[model samples]
Target chain A: MEMEKLYRMHSDRVYSYIYLLVRHRECAEDLTQETFYKAYKGLEAFNKQASTATWLLKIARNVTYDYFRRKRVIKFFSFDKGHDLETNALSPESRYEQKEQLARMFATLSKLKKDYQEVLLLRKIQECSIQETAFILGWTEAKVKMKMTRALEALKKEFHKEGGHPNGTIKRI
Target chain B: MEPSKEFDELFEEMKEVERSEEAKRNTWLALKGRIATKRKRNIFPAFISLAIVAIATFLIITYSIPSETEQSAESLSNEEIIRAVLEREYNGPDKEHLRLMNDWMKFQSERNAKNQEEYDELLESKEYKDFMNYYQTTFGEYFTENMLTKAISTVMVFKYHYYLEDTDIEMHLENVEIKQEKDHPNIYRPIIEVSLTNSQGQKIFHTLREEFIFSKSEPGKIGSYNVAKGGGSIEFREKIENFNSYVGGNEDVRTPSFRKTISFDTLCFNGKIFENENTQKNIHGCTSDRKKINSILKIFDHLPIKEATEQESRKRAEALPQMDNYQIYLTNEVDKGTTFYTITLYEDGVLMFAPGLDLGILGDITTAPHAVIYEKVKLMLDEFSDN
Candidate 1:
């Protein structure tokens, strides 16, 4: 496929997926840089497991997951910057309902463990197939299916406990 | 069926909201910019690495050429000569030279009681000539000038042997009369004052009138030396060309033989030189003043022609650790309180880390050490490696 045509076609979808993972515009922008950087570097690795969009989304998913994994590793070791101040989030009404939902999704998702949150986001919201999700997360297909079910159930429980904000309503769609 | 169609409408609306051209361009542009930046970043480091290689090569070439050319003319200081002599004895080809020196010291001591004829015989020995020749040739010209000077000085010493007791041994300058004693013709007595202090700053002991004996004879010109108890005896007779002039009657000189050894009971007591409150305050003040001096000197060291920027100052300040062996901690902003400076000796690596101190004086915050900031990034990398 022509690189420019592929970029034109998939860039919006890629950005949408990334926006959900990192809510802030600046962070989302940075992640998009990392995602494309990864994509360009590993362009030859794209074997036909799914569509090119799915392949790019998978790359974005893994990149985003790796970012969180790095962050968690740092936090776990007490090597991170101190959580000295509360973080700020975007307004719910500024973007469209889906984008807003994605932003809201990130705020809550940031609270969950890296593994559980990654599986849930890729399988549920991005609507990636079980095999694709498994491949992207480097998990077995069966494990992806099992974890996706468990993660959704866990998310439901968490959303209900938090009184059903965007994350709770995300499931109703 | 109609309600299902309405639900499809909601999904279409969701897709519409999710898919935006602006978001796509923003993300693509962001990625494109980063790729450009990554490429740009490599250029500077590549250029810098080449520059460093060129500079390092130049320095090594310059350092090697001069040292090899002037190997003979290189002059060693007294300290260097002492270290070389000590090292030679440590790794001597044969222990014969060592035995000869020890024998000479003993024979010269014993000759003091004998007649001139016996003393003269001792001085003209082949072993003495061999020892002198070996020291002069092995050490080259550097060692001869310094060693000869040191050997001919008058030495005054007070023996405490008592580590726990700090003694005050005073040698009155007025009482320091240099007089040739009638009994010992070659020796003259000069009184000198000495003081000793214990760890607790207590004067544990006191003394006076310690005598230092020195020979007045010209060392290189001395044809022979006579050692005798009664009426003196000539131990050796050798016509040497010239003698070292460190004996007496010349310019003011502090002979190392008039050495003072301050014995300390413990390691804590050994640092008594700096442990004094006055000394502590003096060092603290001196370090701050030196920082300013270094700041001004660094401007010349780095720029040579231009003034320093904040970043330049920061880099220069960081490099100061190499100049002075002290570790500087940028405890606060450069504009704030004095940064603490300490010297740390790491035994494992045999490394010395000295960071310069910044007291925030001179109203120039630009002079703050950059090591404090640069170390943060290193600490982060170390933490990453640990995981």
Candidate 2:
């Protein structure tokens, strides 16, 4: 019940973060299960300085990378280079169906340096605080802020480059 | 031209990207199996604790503390059933935490000279650190220090209590409406209404309908699993609506292409239309202001993006009935004199309704918080006011 209670409190956010990283539903769920199992095994190490959400996310991040390591898709330079990074089915344009501009923004986003995408997802999409984002990325807050500015600038340029038009929609057959 | 404003709206809109219930349930069901083994291993410690309690009770008391499972769960009455459900959520370990939080909240919120002095002394006392340690594990979600000091209005307090105890400042369950689906005989539907008086002396209400499926053989149980759905339901249903689909071989898939534009000549916003003075365009407006019309139409270009299902649309309408409706009409071909697209804006929240790419898309609507589209239209109108 204790571990189950913890899962009920924080699994969705953890799963969401992992899904975006892994790009496969089943893979993400497996990673989420692994992260919780790790947390259960490593409960003594939790020093109470961080929120349970924060601690769980740190574990989830590690579990996802460990999975990538096992798969031998070791992407060092482009941290955003996860499975399906280039897939048309999972493009930002298709992911955001409500707003074409948002779809455009994400499309532009995917084109930037992959590190930029990594920072932006944490800062922008996840809505993590700078301190939390820094902790998860194992970078300083100053670096996170600096990277965010550069990423937004690059995104603006990429967005305007395409005239932000020709919005891609998947017509099924 | 305001990229900043555009980005702000898009970022805010990003929050509306929904997660489906299927995902949440599937992940939990799959993970529970692995956890069950760990739970079984934990029983040994409890066995040892029970032995220790037996030895201590002979020295300390005349009788042993009674076993908890004195009665079977099978024969629980309706009152007992509801109690079982609530008891599951507000477990024994959390009751003291809940009570202490409420007391701390009262001290923080309704603080007078007398109460403040007592609390300040308590803060100085050694128990404060022990108290903080006690609550750290219980309130893993909220910032305890922040709750006690800053953040006016006790919103976090209210939210914390609401999630844990089905309570706000003071929550009262008004009623429960029970019904059985005629088509699905074994399924039970309970519509529960709860009202709470917030710290601001205002009433806030929440009503949730949770389905409990009963197997005929099991008289007391409601399905294999149940979760009271009050705390964690997302606004955007993550179920992607079918816009375009066909078949390939024996398998099924879709090739999605993003569309940037849709066509309409006549724009009717909130029952006001401007007629194109030339009349050749067959467009009508409030004052024939094409600039305002263009700006207004620009916002809806790719809009009504995600389609809401009939069930989800109906659920939202019932849940948020306070929203005022404002409908807009767009004519595809004025010569045909038919309304091709329709947008009905609910004032509290924005729900854009439109014709589905000239397809048979009935519920072509997507919701955004705070009537963003309505505000955008108003802003465009103000920009072109002189014209």
Candidate 3:
């Protein structure tokens, strides 16, 4: 059945998607359980309008966002620091060549706010198409393009500040 | 300008990621439980046909029974046969049968109220508490997770106790219960209860009677408990055999709700579970949100004073926000389904036990109904302690 195929194809990807947002292995596991429950319960609502992957992606994204909004708002409302960035381990000496550039880049990206982060992550990391990104984000394709461009431009300016080249120093930050 | 391929890879590398095979398996199992429940609910349509059959049978029996003497035979011919067949049909060595048996027992419980009362009296006797405590300490580790959630419109606290014989093996708690209630149709009020118990029987002390309304995750609400009457003092003491018998059919009940319980040999602290490192890791790992983590730390800030351990201090360090400098440590152990959370908070090198804010959020999410009722009793106890 198509249902079984959808499960085989998307289960891992959906698991990966949720694993990033929750950060805890156990919670991501629980949420993944919940996401699949929603998918199976609403299978009748599939409509075939979107691919099963996209449909499941929407459900997983919604679950992650719900958790983020509920759990993140109460504790980190006043937080300016991105919890994700702290988890990144980069030594200063190794990346001295591009330290300022990367710092500027992150600083700029962080400053632009949460919406920009979503669009950038969707387009660049997830490699979602402009339309797919928009659909996932409930934005128009034009909006996705505009946001992606802005995020990229912001990153470029940071690179330019550090000498306009990556230089392959391979520093950990 | 777009990020170059190299930068993209770098960004990907920065994405902190770790996957656990155990966690994946847990997820799949939970999904399986949900799917099974859904399938069970699919019998709703069939219930209508059953209703019709029952009605027709009742009519025939009523007309055929000319005297009260004929009632027993008709009942035997009808109800007894159905009950017998059903009991036989569902008599497999499966969990579902156990669950049905549990349900049947519950349905049969009204007539057994006297027995429950006698048991309650026996337990309430001072002799019983002493005997239970003695047995718990002398025999082996005893952990109990009684009342998944209690406190409908009042403060709810769940309790777990861990006992050790040789090794200080104890209960660990992992899941928190969150409850949301509606007075009218639209208004939603949230309550919470903490659920922690290890596979072995250790206990966690979560008192529900305290005032615990954290920030209203939703606004335009009362933002506090405003009830007229009928709430307080959720009791956690019950006969284990009876309690286990109630939920014996459900295999899910057998799984340690908490991550792991340390044995008596592993007792990091002198007498209590608050001293274990593994317990601390499990508590922090339970919730991924920094906000919730901070909220938990805030709760820890209110616990009554206790001596600290290296492992305990280390556990608190793990919970500290990377950007902030508040020392908050949480350690817990679950033995036999009872979970205990030992939280120590330090600020600027000072210790503190954050007072009650009524954490009944766990009361909502817990699937167990009796546990919810019991949390209300905990809420009352919290008030008593405050007084």
Looking at chain B only, the TM-scores across the models are 0.22, 0.27, 0.19
Report the Cα lDDT for residue B322, model 2: 38
lDDT for B284 (candidate 3): 18
Error of 2 at B73 (Å): 47
Model 2 spans > 4 angstroms off = A74-102, A165-173, B1-6, B39-387
Ranking by DockQ: 3, 1, 2
Return whichever of 1 and 3 wins on lDDT.
3
Tens digits of per-residue lDDT, candidate 3, A93-134, equal 544544443444444445455676677666665556776777
| Interface RMSD, candidates in the order listed | 16.0, 7.8, 7.4
> Ranking under lDDT, best-scoring first?
2, 3, 1
Please state the error at residue B184 of candidate 3 in Å. 27
Q: Residue B340 deviation, candidate 2, in Å?
A: 99
Q: What C-alpha lDDT do the candidate models reach, one value each?
A: 0.38, 0.50, 0.39
The top-ranked prediction according to lDDT is 2
DockQ-based class of model 1: incorrect
Q: Taking the tens digit of each residue's C-alpha lDDT, what string does model 1 give over B77-176?
A: 3333323332332221234444555565555555642333443465455443444333334432432232222221110001111111122221111112
- Write model 1 residue lDDT over A58-142, tens digit each, in one string: 7787777687787773111111132111113434443344443434343444555667677765655566788878777778998
Q: How do the residues B1-387 of candidate 3 rate in per-residue lDDT, one tens digit apiece?
A: 245453674456434344556766566666765654553334111212233334434544454334553223223422232222222222222233234333433433433323223423433333323322222221111111110011110112112221111223222222222343334332222222233233454323322222223223432222233221322222323322133433343432221122133211111111111334434221212323445444333332212233334454444445343211221223323331222332222211223222122111111111232232233322322232312
Q: Model 2 fnat?
A: 0.15
Q: List the candidate 3 regions with Cα displacement exceeding 4 Å.
A: A1-7, A72-111, A158-167, A170-173, B1-6, B11-18, B42-387
